[model samples]
Target chain A: MTAKATAPTPAPSHRGDAEWLSMRERGTVLGIRAAYWLAIAVGRSAMRPLVALVAMWYALFDRKVVRASRAWLLRVHGRPAGFWQVYRHLRTFAQVTLDKVYLLTDHTRALRFTRTGHELLAAQFASGQGAILLGAHLGSYEAMRAGGETTDLPIEILGYFANSRMINSLLARLSPRAAAKVIHLGDDPIGVMTRVQDSLAAGRFIATMGDRTGLTDRIVRAPFFGQEASFPAGPFLLASVLRCPVYLVLGLYRAPDCYDLHCERFAERIELPRQDRAARLQQWVRRYAERVEHHARSAPDNWFNFFDFWAAPPAAPPSPPPP
Target chain B: MSQTDATLEDQLKRLIVDTLALEDVAPESIDTNAPLFGEGLGLDSIDALEIALAIHARFGVRTVANDEKNREYYHSIKSLADFVRARQGEAQASAAPA
Candidate 1:
């Protein structure tokens, strides 16, 4: 029997209420399987109309996703997002998602990439001291990964995958080699850290998302797109603890068949002194958030965070005014 | 608990307090059996990493990541002390001879 779908209510009550981790995957396994095989068989160019249909389906029926896309587009464009704009946003997401199939299947010969700041990655590789690749949910990280694979760079993905198990497993099956490179973050904190340290020591890049926070993640608020939003401090904190260089990498999907891969050295090392640890974390996280904002604005349709990005924490009870 | 285990736990408590710069929390006030994460002390994974680093630096015992018993070993001050002591024993045994 198919699992009953539970639509997540978007009411902002607690921090977990708006957390992306609490949201369920949108499509069904059977539907995803069919789409995957269809994309693989008919190729990306032929699947555009079908993908648009799927994106349109979500845009029309999935009220939560539509509301989120509209809100995000409004913030970035400084105007109410029209229905087509939201549709385009979802369509971009769908197109990028479809590309992951080709990316993982070793069929990247057809893909084209224009990389900026590639020398930064080259320098780190030459130094034999692996760097952390900090990316966001803005664009297709898989594009960057596919590029790394082509260039013979050993890149491992470090992420939490509980939410997208179905798709992750499907992609894993498509490319066991790529899936083997994943370091899943789970209950075993020590295990994860040890593996990360070992990978860095061995000069393998660890790519992780810096935007979304897990349910129990420590967070710091940063101003993004003219409003304060919570960003996870874990990525910055891990960078500091690992004492490694960090580089901001984004693969903006240009329509049709091109990806503009942008890479910039973010920091040599993030230092969080005990005396001002919280402030230091805030500074680093804010800087990262600013970088994400810059890219998100440049490629507004590439923005993929389909949640209430600006949900404020539950309001504290007001105190009596001084007499 | 033996006196030495108690002493080790106290030492770890002080190390955690100092390493994490946990303001408003006295080392002695920390319960030996109270959870260090998500509840009693409310420490998170970052804190766990900090503690692991400090434990390695102070005790010369590396807390191997990916160990199936990491969750158990890092559960509390007492458990951490036990983990350190066991690792120290293993180190000594290995360094002794073939």
Candidate 2:
């Protein structure tokens, strides 16, 4: 007799009640995957019409995503967002997703990147010290990876991989270099952290996104664009324990087959004394939010949170009366 | 507990509390057999790494590449302090004007 399959236990989440958090693998659309292969067989220029068609279809049909897009655009642009503007935002997202196939599948000819702040990364590498490259959904992290591939530094990415294992394995089969570097974060936090420590010890760059909260950790709430949002406390805590420099890395898509890879030093080192752990966590989280807001203003279409980022924050626990 | 082991445990507890910046955790309150990971101390992988670093800095012990053995060594404060003491003894013996 077949034993009943046990249901998987959901990891505790410290994120806001944003609808996107419930969705699995936003980039796993079958049509998009098929088009990616077609773009590979033909050129990205030939695939443009298809990408635009797909983007337009989503803009017209997916009301929730379009509405979210409009809300984010209005918030960033400081003005009423028009339908055409929202459509452009969706189109940019679709274009970036399409470019991922080229970036990850080893089709490098399609991308032309202008890099800044790379000297900071080079200096960190030269010092024989590991660093945390905190990134966001605002741009192509794949481009950042591609740009850094030329350097001898081994780059490892920390991301959720349970739902995308099949797709990840398939893609990894196509690009072994990218596959070897991923340290899956969800299954076991202890395992992930130990592997991260190993990578840092071996002088590898540990890259993770700071904008999205992990599903299994406590969040540090901070103000984003004048509204409260929750950010994961893990990376910042990891930075403190590791006592290493932290840098912000973004790879904004500039044009068809072109991107501007930007990197900026975020912190010399994260220090969390026992007396100031709470306040320090909040301070660093707020600083990260400010940087994300600044970048989102410049590339209005690149903010990929696609959820109600300004939702009401959870209530803080009451403090005990002073003695 | 012997005076030496008690002192080692106290030193390890202080090292852990300071290195991890743990809140609400006093060194004297840490149990000798309490696990270093997960539910016991609520410490994650980064804490394990920091503990490893602290052990190296204070006792000149390095974590091996074998993850299973490392986990055994890091199972509890008692296990970790024992590993450090043994390693220190070995180092001292090897360097004793041979």
Candidate 3:
């Protein structure tokens, strides 16, 4: 007999009302998988609407998610940009999010644009050089997956996986070629780092999140976008341990289907100096900030860090209790 | 099912409370008749799998997914305890060789 499909029981009062929402999330996950198979089996047109719907939903929603997102933008940026500025960035973020689906489904030449920063990636990977590909939450930065597809290079990503195994299995089956290359170390901190170190030792590329904290407190404080916030130390520490060249590889979504795969040489060969490791990390952190800063300043909304950011003082103690 | 075994029941309740990270839940508050995953302790699919794994490793009792009776037995701590008791008794009976 097949394993019983036991779904999570959401909170009670809204149990009857919430079934639709729970189904929606499941649908969203399935849609993503279906889009993948559609891309491979039925080809490109099958995925166009899937990508479009993702972008439109984020762009059109004004109150619930968008309103909260706008508040998040204010808190992170310290001030609001013009209407067009916010809209442009949100549109870019949405488009890039969709762009990932399109990239996964389509072939290489199906991509429209120059391979702008690929040489930088190769140069960093040459010899015993293994660097962290520090990426922002902005754009559909799945270009690295595409890169592994195009080149014989072994690129492994240290990232979060969906909670659903069904989805994971489908994704692996969908893109068997690139799926083997992508190393998604979801919750295992020690194991994740070990895999990164192992992959690098084998002269393979390991890419992880430049921003965001893991479940526990694997976060470190840093100043970004003009405020004190934390970015995961996994990227920097992994770079230090492996002693590899580090590049900030980002794929910016320019339009509906098209994207600009930009790879800039942020830093090559960073030294921990044997004594002051934190200082060495700060130097690399500054370089990561500079690289992201370059793009974020140009396309402010394209920086899709959904949670609160730089506005808060680093580890500013929790606010006083309300009377 | 009414064993009047308060200590053993409390120990199991504590395990449920701690393992699942049931934030607002109290051990005494969890009703024996209420569902542990859904209506009672409020756990999810991943948590259910985790709890199932925890039960197998801790108790040395491997739960059979194929068993139709597991639907009623896996529903609550009391039900689960009874199933375990029955299984253990069967083991003892077989070991004694008639």
Candidate 4:
């Protein structure tokens, strides 16, 4: 049964969740606009040093975030991380965030994007049988959107905004068209399903992140980075319900203005039978985790989840015998 | 129920119980009109996909892959039986000479 939330609610705050929450709340649209205009005027070449300086400031002041980044980098890199490594990690995130200004403002002429497996998306579009693009927070999702604009395929993002009120208005102000494509998960579940169905039926691609989960979102445990981690079940469920093909898409930020966009066909369709629900779901989740880990290892800093990812969960007592 | 149709329904009911591992619910106890999903048998999207696979395996009839479109066919045992019967009829007619 679909959980009862027609509207987005506050995601339970873990360290990682809080970082995302605070990052937006700490800065206003005006501030983002100022950075955008500055980058545009001086060019990314001139803005690099300034962005690094800002990244350094955050790394120094935000102890919690730095610790989280440092811990993740250690696992991803398989080596001890120093202050400079952590700083670079934070800087990568800042640079990508700043680039959104250029991306949304229709000034991405300088950024270079190389896409692989784009033919899969093209084929899906050509067939008028749309597919689901399951993405993660590892890189610049905006780069994918930029590519979508160029390819002329309609892309709608499915996301749950914890502080959507503020961000939504900013999105409306910055790019009204972009704001319209967002299918907020916090809205009514049935409404979300209907809208998603319409989009798929119209052969438009729906982009959703498979990495994160909402406060109430049901999740399954899978092996990630050599340890079991919780991954959200919503993406697979959506694919099964839609009966659509699934594709894995990632836009890895390479340099100042270069990104490598990768698209891999994940599955023709998700077929989960009731008899082995847990095991079947686990297999799919494991495959996704392995793929994400492969990408994250290549670009360690681009992995945006800044939390104690490997922390142990609260204890669970043994279950009673079944009836 | 006619012998042939009764056997078809009984076969489908058995498949549902076996594929879904609903061990507690006996095949004969499944009300043909009782819903198979949410608020009925309390199945979810995953369960729906599984049932589709089971249907394909047992009857050699391909249910429409899209859940939105498949809702009518999967609504209950009666609907599923009718869907299978219709498809099997079409297959037989196409194969027979005029």
lDDT of 1 by residue, A1-323 (tens): 01002233433335543444434233323434556577778887888887788788888887877998999988888889988998899888888877867777767766788888888888888889888999998878877766563356778777765434565677567777763366667647777887787888889899888888766667789999999998878889889988999999999998878888998999999998888988999999889989999998889999877778778744532422211
Candidate with the greatest DockQ versus the true structure = 1
Q: lDDT of all the models against the reference?
A: 0.77, 0.73, 0.56, 0.72
Docking class of 1: acceptable
Considering the true interface contacts (CA pairs under 8 Å between chains A and B), give the fraction that model 3 also has.
0.00
DockQ of each: 0.44, 0.25, 0.02, 0.08
In model 4, the Cα lDDT at residue A115 comes to 84
lDDT of 2 by residue, B20-67 (tens): 776577888888898777657767666776787777787778775434
Indicate whether candidate 3 or candidate 4 has the larger TM-score. 4
TM-score of 3: 0.59
**Descending-DockQ candidate ranking:** 1, 2, 4, 3
Ranking by TM-score: 1, 2, 4, 3
Candidate 4 similarity to native, TM-score: 0.70
Tens digits of per-residue lDDT for model 3 on B9-62?
Answer: 565676677665555668877776667644455443334444554555555555
- Clash pairs of candidate 4? A6-A187, A6-A188, A7-A186, A8-A186, A273-B50
Over the true interface residues, superposed, what is the Cα RMSD of model 1? Answer: 8.7
Cα lDDT, model 2, residue A228:
86
Off by over 4 Å in 1: A1-33, A148-151, A163-172, A177-180, A314-323, B1-6
Candidate numbers sorted by lDDT from highest down = 1, 2, 4, 3
Q: How good is the docking of model 4, by CAPRI class? A: incorrect
| Selected candidate, larger TM-score, 1 vs 3 | 1
